[model samples]
Target: MPHSLPPAAPLRGRFDRFLILGAVCLAGFVLPLNFTGPPIATPAIAAELGGSPAALTWMTNAFMLAFGSCLMAAGALADGVGRKRVFGIGIAAFGVASSLLAFVPDLFWLNVLRVVQGVAAAAALSGGNAALAQEFHGAARLRAFSLLGTTFGIGLAFGPSLAGWLTQTHGWRSIFLSSVVVATAATVFGLPRMRESRDPAAAGIDVPGSLAFTAMLAAFTAGVLEAPARGWGHPLVLAALIGSGLLLALFVRIEQRSRRPMLDLALFRYPRFIGAQLLPIGTGFCYLVLIVLLPARLIGVEGYGALQAGLLMIALSLPMLVVPFVGAVASHRVPPGVLCSGGLLLAAAGLVWLGRADPGAGWIAPLLLIGIGAAVPWGLMDGLAISVVPKERAGMAAGIFGASRVSGEGVTIALASAALATFLGAGLQAALPGHAGRVAEIAQHLGIGDLAQARALLAPTLDPATLIGVYERAFGHLVDALAAATTVTAVLVLSLFGGASAHDIANTHEAPAARADGRPERVADCGAHG
Candidate 1:
């Protein structure tokens, strides 16, 4: 049986709904801030609390991996329990975790706390969004979600600059402290106004499926992040890589057998669904990786101050604020396939252009171009995610889509970061022939935007200018590779999204649901409901 809402009369009014939207938006805003802030603060964090290259990477990866892996489970938990209850718990836990992060003394504890924060975030996001959905209908829901997206964009747009200012003025720890305040406000204001709701038909949480998927993601990410430090052939690295594959196979088997699988393996049969899933993964490499890596490059290799680097990053993120709305409007006239695939192709070009631009004054154009291109799919992916699935399975589609996007970002950043470290180390080895053994250590520092520490590891006779040049070259190569990858993804998405009209797909390949006349029931397009 489908879940049903309570009587509309007592649920909420216009003002109350707006209040709920505001509260949810507040909580939602912090999530992007958490993601974008750490990379900017990374240099300062390293300067104050030392960590290994992999450990430093974990500061960000731990949060993302935990959040992504737990999101589907968190959604199910929210639906199984009460949305308000889970939302409040998540917000309170997030505040507490963030408070602890502010006082953490070492990298290990900080990473652990970040994972806690991530799980809290997953709960908060899943519960908050679902609760908000219950509060509005039709056009109101569309507008509410749009505002939520804008809030997230604002967070992404300003998080780096805000974090930079805070890091420069107070300390890296202030970033966590600030997030705590946002979480607190969200909990205080949102909880009372929100009524409790749950899915009566929701099965218990899929523990086995969740565990297998989480373990697979963790194993794979560990292999990727550790590989450059520990050679690919190292026992642990090999074990993690092999174990990741085994876990993935096991996850599929588990899901197939489960009465209520977290993911519907049958959904993968749809080419359009696969294409929709690719949108985030494509942007993950072309845009999300750059969001983390660019600030480090500006601060470490190009010798920009944290504040300067953050300000420069605005060019890349600002388009997210407005271009998405434009793309959403443009979708009325143009097919989404063109908009999505074309946007990625444009971003790929921007990546190539960025690779060639001078580090200082020449960056804004390419960054803005990339931002504008990536924003299109960013805006439309939610609708596309649901449009490709059966109407009854919209929630499942959304949960899986969210997981894919977040998990893809975590995995992509690990791979990109490792590749960057390898390239930088190789460059440094060639630049300083006698210091090959220490290049990995130096590259690790440089990779996190700790140029000062990286310099200390080098010979006093070696010019700082040579190291900067080598870093620039390595980064350039990485950008070129990202562009190539994005181009290939764009082509694949184009092929996948083409060849069939939505009507044809719905008529021919609709789920087993049938009409009274023995005809297959047509699946409605997401836009029709919106």
Candidate 2:
């Protein structure tokens, strides 16, 4: 039986809903800030901590892998244990971990703390929608979701800038300290007032399934992250990749057989659900590629500081903020598939335009185009994803969506890193052909015999302008690759849009009696309805 919402209680007021939204949004801020802060401060952190190139990569990738892998388990746990309680605990733990990071003495300890932070972040990110879905209904629900999207957009936009400023002024420690304060405040305010929202009929925790899924994700991520350091054929990396495949196979089998599976395999049977999930995967792949490439191009290639790089990236966020309103309006009149497809196309065009940008080109035009293009897809994807699912299963639906986005991002970054290494290596090898022996010696000294190693060796021999030129050429290759990848992804998403549109049209024409989950008949169901 479906879990029904409680009758409209006079005690549940607008203020309560606002509190829930505010708390969730505040908690959401910490994770993005933690994720972005290190990237902006990479140079500084690496300098102080005596880290190699690989260590720096771990600082960011560890959080991503942990956050992505644990999301499904966190979602099921939220539904079983209680949304408010899980969210509060997660927020508090994140605060504690972030605070500890402020005093981390070495890169290893920092990575350890980041993994803990990631776990806490998974808890908060997973439960956020379920909490909102439990609190508001109808237009209020729509408004709350819109606000949540806006909060996420703002966080992504501002996180790097905040990190840049703090890293420049007070050092990287301040970034973690700031996260501690923000997370702590959210946990404090949210604990007493946040109401519990759990479906009593949901099955018990799927411990075996969760373990299998986690192992699969961990192994897969480790393989991706290690590919650059160890050749693709390295035994440990190969073994991890093979083990991940086997675990994933086992996970699917378990889900099929378990009475209380963490994932409901049946959701994929709905074309609308499948389309909704794919939208994020496509968007996430493009988004991370752009996010990582833009900063490296601006700061590393163009010799910009952390602040300048962050400011340049703000172009990506500006459009993300404004386009959702367009999506919201479009959602009311246009079919979601039409809006989503259009948004993705626009974003693809923007990335293409960005790829064509010259090293010294005026920044405003490209920035404007990217802002507009990126915004459209960001505004509409989440709401559209949830629209297809039954309201009672919103938590699971959201969990799946979040997992797709996170996993896509992780894979995208890994691929982009590999591509970047290849391009950078080619450029370095070409630029210093006759001096290969000397370059190799320098690379050994620098402990970076990769493409970046070659570039560093050539840096000392070339003039400042020529060094800049070499980096620009290398970075351009990455931009082109990202654009091509994004375009392919956009085209695929457009195809999904067609399928989703057909589903929406069928749903629209169907009689209310035919609708599953009794959504059309119930008012309370509308509030917490995904």
Candidate 3:
């Protein structure tokens, strides 16, 4: 059945508007809080659960995979049914999952509950953004989206420190328990007042397209994530990669034919839209990956306690809180392409700076620069992408945009893990120049999170200077690789923006001639952005 539009009520007051943003934005807070929190809590979780470093990695992945997978479909459902209904369900579901996670009997159960949490987060994000797009128009839309971005940053900024403190003092389970309380309260208060809005004309979700895309992302991530431990050439890894390729091809075909595709392949026809999509991937790789990796590096390599490392990361996260508002305000004056491309290049510069930064000087400066740079695109791109679509499909567009983000995060981590593993293996070889057989054993031991072993593992044969150089070079290689990837991504995004029209730059949904069908015609002279 088609969605029935809610009767337009009187113009809400300032308090009501604030509450609307809070209702949605508060839900937005759930994801980053849980996702980044785990890196800080990993040691405690693993110690209690008796798992390895790889197992700890899955604690993040299990949630990410499910979140990315359900996002597109959830968006479609929200568009067809109603944003408030889906948003309420998402909050209740996440609250339930978080409560379950608080008492999870083992690591396996914790991971399982994370998937449920991801699904709930997906619905909440899509429904919240869709509601904002529906309720606010023109300049108010920009401000509303900015607030949404700001709320998202707040979640990211606090996740590490809070998780660290809670895990250190109250225990790892406190992190989840806290969320249970917050989410339950938010659902009780926020959901009731969240006015229902959705795309009345939207066809039901394209099941085949959604499943194929999910399969493609899942297989690809599985291949990349596991390749570090299993080897790229391992039968399982190769099979996964091959399956990902096949699934990707099938997804394209399905979308091309489906009347109501979850992801309209034609949206890529707009260079700005493509840039909008790719921009997030770079941001995710540069920003969120930093959120996870820096904590691990500080706590593991530098020998800082979890709490100390988390506190230090505040330098990196604080700028994220302010930059979104700056970018949102700047978007009115500057082109989306310019803001996005500039943000991407700035972030890449920060990555390169961090890649080469002297350990003695500390990461605070480079981390600060990275936060400022990432905030521009992170703050602006969602509004930019959704601007390319029609208002009715805002929920669906939001879903696709978010799916790209979470997918990028998962893929980047997987790639980073692979590169890190490769770098570590090479470091072992470099430290013990003549000992080929010992390298594999030493690498395996290091994978379990013992940083003291760099010198100790190779002590009898290698000197202190050699041991230190090995680690320095290994970390440098990982950082440099990420920097290179970001630079390349930025250049491509810039090129896309260079060729886009004014319409693409303004707001994707407002672009003229768009229809309910998934197909988009070749856009020539689609008006200029100004």
Candidate 4:
């Protein structure tokens, strides 16, 4: 059933407050469950399905690609049609997709199912975030967002250990089934208690803008993910890269001209908004991109079991638990710009320290430092995405925020994974000096990450010691690259922050409300619609 929009009203809880908070928690929990859970299961999935490294990358990227591409459109639909209805449908669809995944026959089907799940996620996640911004206000709004932050933190904290133990004890398929159970429970808890809400002023969906955005993201993602296997100069890959650029230019042109654009290009005028959008890219580079690789590094290279590897990942996610509390204090006292700048600086430094780690005891400190630095700043950005805009546009703002963060994670993962495979291949060629032909075959095995099998295959052709040396060197360089990316993000964010503190800029640049005739009003009155 579809939800209908009524006249605009003050932001208030039409349902039980506790139920509202509970539903928001569920939405937040699912974010990391979908993204972070799969990495823990990747090794097991690859072994069972015989997926190539590129195929395995698609298993994750396909979902993120769809999620990022669909987010703004879904958010716009929620604003015009109904937030609760769209959100409930998304949750139901997500559960169905996860159930189907348990029975997916091959890697191809698995990737397709993941895309479906990602599309569903865009609705539920953005709607839930928008709902929070629409319902709560003042201190309660701050508290609600903080709770939302902790929920995802808990999800990321639980994902690795839970997914690893489940995959090891049951099988890789159990991971999908587990997600089904969680999504079902969230749907049940949310639908009945959730209130229907919408922006009456919202224009109809911008079909061209939506299609163009989706195509642009899809082409770009395919280009990056396939470039490693198909050479960078391959015809299809080159076409995708060029096509994505053209689509991006087209999307920009459309937004600039559309009467009611899906993405309001005016948002970019605020330097603070631009700065807020960029922070997610940093988090994706410094934190999420690394999480995806840690399990492979630990279980594949260091001889740890799945469960043990999952446990080791706790060092990175544990600090996430305290993020909301850290965020609460920072949001109330410090300027957001200052907090973000300082936090990213600390995070970049931590990543540099982590890059130099030698597969030993000293690795723990930098991991914890990076985790804290990344997670705490993330909490500040959660509310700013909605708060910076007029209350009527919360859904739009939430969608863009979701797109930025999810797309950053998706694209960064592809880049990181591509780099990992390329470097490893070069290292193997060096290690297997006399066996040039065998090097290619061994590279394929290692690239897809059947590392134990690669070791076995190489033992007959080269010295075992030399093979281990190659892995260590390749892995060290990958971490160095990740460190470099984070440091660059830090420097860019610092420049974008400019001179104003977050508190000052946010107060001065609050989005103006639009009149019925589409003229802008100067009131900063949040109680009017937000």
> Candidate 1 vs candidate 2: which has greater lDDT?
1
> Model 3: per-residue lDDT, tens digit, 39-72?
7877667668866556667888889888888889
- Tens digits of lDDT, candidate 4, 323-369: 65776576557656667667777777777787677664667888888
Off by over 4 Å in 1: 1-11, 138-143, 387-395, 499-530
TM-score of each: 0.91, 0.87, 0.91, 0.91
For residues 1-530, what per-residue lDDT tens digits would candidate 2 score against the true structure?
Answer: 34454453344666766776788878766676677667778767766886767677778778887887777788778877887777877888888898899999999999999999888888887787777777765556656666676566567666777887888789989999998888877776665676777755466567888789778877887786666456579999899899999999999999888765667676565455555665655555445556655655566556677787777677666666667787777666666666665666666666566666764346556656655655666666666555544555556656777777676677677767765555544554576687655633332222221234435555645555544555566556665666666566666555555533323432322112112342222211111111
Per-residue lDDT over 443-513 for candidate 1, one digit per residue giving the tens place of the 0 to 100 score: 88888776777778875666788878888898999999999989988998878777443334333333433
Global lDDT of model 4: 0.74
How far is 472's C-alpha from truth in model 2 (Å)? 3.0
| Of 2 and 4, the candidate ranking higher by lDDT | 4
The predictions' CA RMSDs to the true structure, in order, are: 3.8, 4.8, 3.2, 4.0
Question: Which should have the higher lDDT, number 3 or number 4?
Answer: 3
- The whole-model lDDT of each prediction reads 0.79, 0.66, 0.75, 0.74
Instruction: Tell me model 3's lDDT, rounded to 2 decimals.
Output: 0.75
TM-score for candidate 3, residues paired by index: 0.91
Span of 10 residues, lowest total lDDT, candidate 1: 521-530
